[model samples]
Target: MLLKKSPSNPIQAASMGINKTEDQAISGWERLRFLYEQPSMERDLSRRIINMAFLTGFFFGGVATSAQARETFERSNIGQRFLSASDVLKRQADYAIVRFAKSGFPMGFKCALVSGSIVYADFLKIFHCG
Candidate 1:
């Protein structure tokens, strides 16, 4: 024997149009069809492209700045000496001494070295450089 299901609520049954077929229900792709049919689709697409380009440029700009900083640090006098130092000394050394002039005072800077190059430096103290 087969059983026929009946609507539990009269209002819901009327709103749902009991005669409507299952095929009339909206599907996932059909719901998104309105986006493609929109008049401002081209404007939205152009905005998305511009946003992506700006993000890409910002990311690469940061990378380039980091590389430039590393290069500048490596070209300094203290950086040159640090790179030429023996591996054992490089491992033990964590500070660099800097002198601004021939008779100038010396300054010590705490530094982090990586791949035989200075990656970071922070001022530690001013001291005699005799």
Candidate 2:
């Protein structure tokens, strides 16, 4: 008569290569490798990146639109309030005379100040020497 043998554990069976489909608990290193080799994982990462970029672009576009709308509204509202050509000329003449008077001193002072300001301004001007 032959004696009966005891059944081996899953780990011992798999290690002996006699048993297959071992769904038993995997070690830390094996689980990590399995996850690293998994397919469709990169798709999840890429989807998140694309979504973030789209949101950033959308936010900036909204800001730009608001800025443009505000500028348009200001232009429309202020156009009617701007001074007319005749009014502008009268105001400029009035302002120049006031500025000249405020410069103080005499006619000689006026000539010297005017000539100095003009000379420096002309030097700063762009010239097409051609």
- Top TM-score: which candidate number? 2
What C-alpha lDDT does candidate 1 achieve relative to the native structure?
Answer: 0.35
Name the regions of candidate 1 deviating beyond 4 angstroms: 1-39, 73-130
Q: What TM-score goes with each of the models?
A: 0.27, 0.28
Instruction: Using lDDT, give the best candidate's number.
Output: 2
The alpha-carbon RMSD values of the candidates against the true structure, listed in the order shown, are 24.1, 30.6
Q: For residues 14-98, could you state the per-residue lDDT of candidate 2 as single tens digits?
A: 2333433436533434333332344444334444554555455544444445545545545555545546779755654554444
lDDT of each: 0.35, 0.41
Clashing pairs in 2: none
Task: Report the Cα lDDT for residue 92, model 1.
Answer: 38
lDDT of 1 by residue, 40-102 (tens): 443355445545554555454444455444444456534344454585355333222111211
2 in model 1: Cα distance from truth in Å? 46
TM-score (C-alpha, index-matched) for candidate 1: 0.27
